[model samples]
Target: MSTERRAPLDRKRVADTALKLLNEVGLEGLTLRAIAKELDVKAPALYWHFKDKQALLDEMATEMYRRMVASAALDPADSWQERMLKANRGLRAALLSYRDGARVYSGSRFTGTDHAREMESNLRLFTASGFTLAQTVRANSTAYSYTIGFVIEEQGVKPLPGERREGYDVQERARLLAEFPLAAAAGAEIFEDYDRHFEEGLALIVAGVESWTRLG
Candidate 1:
C-alpha cells in the first residue's frame, strides 16, 4: 500500500474549501478545524495560507464579490432604474446562495482592487443616472444596506418549518389577521410574495433617488 499524502494548499484552495464548508455548515458551524478536516490537512496547515479565520473569510468575500459582479454585468442600453434593479436583485441572490452568506460577505473588509473597481463602476453608474457625487454615495449605501438587512432577516438560521420569513410564522399571521382585518389585509399582500416585495421596495428607493436628483 502506497500513501503519498495530499497536494500542497494555496490561498484560493483554502478559500474555496471554506466556501464549501460555509454552504454545508453555515457561518456558526464554520471553523478552522472544520475546513482543515475538509482539506484533509492539519489545522496548522491552513495557517500557512490564512493567518486566521478572518483572512479566509475575507478571501471568501472577495470570491463572492467577483462572482456577483461577473453575473451582474451592465449594458450601456440599460436605463438607470434597470441597472439599479438588476444590481440589487443580483446582490440579493448571491447573498442568499450560501448558508449565512450575507453574514460572511458583510463582515469582511472591502480592500481588494476588484472590490474597488466594482464600487467605482457602481458609483459611475449612479452619477451617469443624474445623481450628484454625494447623492450617488448615499443612494448606493441605502440600497446596499436595505439588501443586506432584508437578507439577514430573511435568512433566519436554517430553513424553518414553512421556510419563508413571513410565511414561516403562519399561526401568528393568521391570529393577527383575525384580530385586525384592516391591518392584516394590507400586510398580507406585502408578505405573500417575497420576490415581488423586494422589487417593490427597491423601486421605492429608486424613486426616492429620482426625486432627490430632481429636487436637489
Candidate 2:
C-alpha cells in the first residue's frame, strides 16, 4: 500500500467541505454522509467533528461570517448609516453566495465567539454616537432581522444568483394579478431589481434608526 495519508478531519475542514457540497446538493440534500463522502471519509468520521447536521450548519454559518468579515473593508470612520449599509450589504452578499445560503444561516448558531468581536465594535459605534445600550441593541437587531428576512424571500425567488424558480416568472406573476391592475403593475417592482430594493429598504431602516436616536 502507498504511504500517503489523508488530511486529518477537523471542524473547519468538515464545514468547508459541507459548504462546497451545499452548492451542489443544497441544504435539504446536504447530510453528514454527503459531506463525509466528499471528504473521502466515512460518515462516522464526520460525527467526531460535528455531532449532527445542525452542528455542521452552525459551523458553516460561522465560516460564512468569517469570510464576510475578511472580505469587507469596514472603516472605523464610517457614519452609523454607512456602517449599516455596508454591513447589511455584505451580509446579503454572503447569504446569496451559496445555494440556500440564507437558509443555512437563518437559525444556525455560531460555533465560535468570533461574532462577539463584531458585535462589540457595532455596539461601541452606536453608543459613541449617543445611542443607549438598549437602543443600540434594538437598532442592530432590526437591521439584522431585515437583512435576514429579505434574503430569505430573495432566495425563495432566486435560489442562486441568476437562477429563478419556475413559478416566479415576472410575466406569469403579472398575468396572475391581471385582474388587479395596480398589483399586476407592481409585479416588476416586486420581483425585478432586488438589489435596488434591498438598498432602498435598508436606507429606510437606517433613516428610521437615525430619527429614533435623535429623539432619544
Estimate the Cα RMSD of every predicted model relative to the unseen true structure: 3.0, 1.2
Indicate the worst ten consecutive residues by lDDT in candidate 1: 157-166
Tens-place lDDT digits, model 1, residues 1-216: 879866669877888888888877778899999999999889998888779878889999888888888886667677778877888899989988878888887868753788776668777877877777898888888888988877776677333224553354544666767877776566555445667877888999999988877888
Segments in model 2 whose C-alpha atoms lie over 4 Å from true places: none
- Compared with the true structure, what per-residue lDDT tens digits does model 2 show for residues 113-211? 988888888888878988889998899889999999999999889989889988878888888888998998888888889999999999999999988
lDDT of each: 0.78, 0.89
Error of 1 at 122 (Å): 2.5
Candidate 2: Cα lDDT at 54: 89
Error of 2 at 55 (Å): 0.8
| Superposed Cα deviation of residue 5, candidate 1 (Å) | 7.2
